[model samples]
Target: MLRAGEPGATGYREALEALCRAYWLPLYAYLRRRGCNCHQAEDYTQGFFARLFERQALVRADPTRGKFRSFLLAALKNFVADERDYAQASKRGGGARALPLDFGEAEARYALAPSDTLSPEEFFDRSWALAALQQAMAKLKAEYAEAGKEHLFERFKGSLQVDANVASYRDMAADVGMSAGAARVAVHRLRRRFRDLVRQEIAQTVSEPAEVDEEVNYLFAVLTASV
Candidate 1:
């Protein structure tokens, strides 16, 4: 049986860890793009995760009100507002409040350069969408691995992407030693599973179930805008 956000065996600690792993990059990127120096961004990002874990916020998350990304951003905004002064006042022995985060490297990887065409808000939205997709993919891969169909999953995983230019069903069937009809069915099932996994991933972040569609629409808009 799959144990996601269920009450029993939910293991709040484990779930929080997973959520941090999944969202830390997006949060970090958001902070960096907002003009925080690398060190401050890292500190803020780490502190955000620490606070989230300390508060057991995930236990009370309800996917019925809004998208998880919205909730997280709002929380992050509030955290920064509340902690800015305190964080700025505190300093290391060197007398620098900044924690010496490698913002340059982070910038190269996650931050958008001024020359980039996308606005900060657009960048954050796209980053959020990609992060959500990655989380969904990770869960799907784990499910396939657990079901002993890892090979099948790898064979068709590329087809899930919008711009994959995936192989024809006949070619996929030949590669997998399955009939063309089976290959078609397999791809359909794969898409269905991916959608379910993506929905579940988004669901875990929000406060209400109704927010899933809204989030999905926003994500798609981000993707579309990028292209």
Candidate 2:
């Protein structure tokens, strides 16, 4: 992402936009949990990214700060503190460029967040975890589609996380026209594949391959904590 921070770099703008698109929801949810209403939170989130990229604040990232996610949250908190008037700020004011963020969907998603007194940071962590899990699942589904097994994947995927004793292999077998034993095997393989994809997804966010496991554990911990 350092390229994204470079002035006048080719594709830097697109790279930064992609990054914002991926993480904006979590940031928006974080702001909401801090008591910003939907419109206020949307404005803050849009302004935050606009100012963040325009000022090239990404150049301030340091390995010592650890995960990029944590660094982002810290930067956002600093931005909000300094830009207290964001609630009234317009996209054109302060030369802030408008991004095409979908705040309507963002608010819809935020409405499903845990209501059990989670701190803003915890909510951000949970949102990040959910986003990563979603990306992994999307990738897994695409691979199944490529192999012409999308139907099978769909029928067996529910068992990937369900306890073997709780999941009905018989029902899945009937749905997929497979024997119960084959349905069990399909779920086993799909679960293994899904785990690998999740690890791969985590690998993208960390500084090193060694950090993937630690990040994975942290995200899963956040998920369980939310539950």
Candidate 3:
């Protein structure tokens, strides 16, 4: 039922909402990394989403042009460039509105990696990928927790990151108190779940399901270049 290129149609609002939910964290991280203070970043992030509700912007979005993340980042860069001074302006009618933001978490994540060599576009894509992965992992962990396999999820999640010297299946199995076969199975399942989640994440922003692989490859390239 989720057709593309119909921003004013009955399902358009729902589709856009889903896209925002998937990308908000990455956009926030990009803003925070670009030297915006926590409050300014929060406002800008909220404002960016608010602008998407504009008929002009939504109706003009062309999925055929490529990845929605790219379109969004470009829009955000233009928005910031255009609104450079608005963040510091005094309010006329009342005190500044409180923009809802997860400042604590944003600050924590930013603090962990305060520097990067990637261009703004690359950084945005990298952040997008990370956010998508985080959301997918959270959902998977919750499912595991609900099924009384929280420990298993915890053990595997720790090793999801790519590393040149990653431990072997036998080593991880020993560390997690599971047999090598069981560890291998768990890791395989986790990888499959991660891939499915990534596809789902990409599908939300794209007009066509066939475009998922292309977006996924671009995401990997962005992450690689950023790192």
Q: Best lDDT goes to which candidate? A: 2
TM-scores for the candidates: 0.73, 0.83, 0.78
> What's the lDDT for residue 216 in model 2?
85
Off by over 4 Å in 1: 1-17, 53-65, 85-115, 162-167
Q: What is the lDDT of residue 44 in candidate 1?
A: 76
**Tens digits of per-residue lDDT for model 1, 33-56:** 777777667777666666665554
TM-score of model 1 relative to the true fold?
Answer: 0.73
Ranking 1 against 2 by TM-score, winner: 2
lDDT on C-alpha atoms for all candidate structures: 0.68, 0.77, 0.69
**RMSD (Å) of each candidate, 1 decimal:** 5.6, 3.2, 3.8
lDDT of 2 by residue, 1-227 (tens): 34444447788677667656777789999999999888778777777787676754556654234676777788788777767675346533333545887777998888777688889999999999988888789889999999999998887777777766524888888888988888888888999999999887666566567878889889889999887
Tell me which residue pairs clash in candidate 2. Answer: none
Off by over 4 Å in 2: 1-15, 63-65, 91-98, 165-167
Model 3 weakest 10-residue run by lDDT: 89-98
Q: How many clashes does each candidate structure show, in the order listed?
A: 12, 0, 0
lDDT of candidate 2 vs native?
Answer: 0.77
The number of the candidate with the highest TM-score is: 2
User: Candidate 1, after superposition: displacement of residue 207 in Å?
Assistant: 2.3
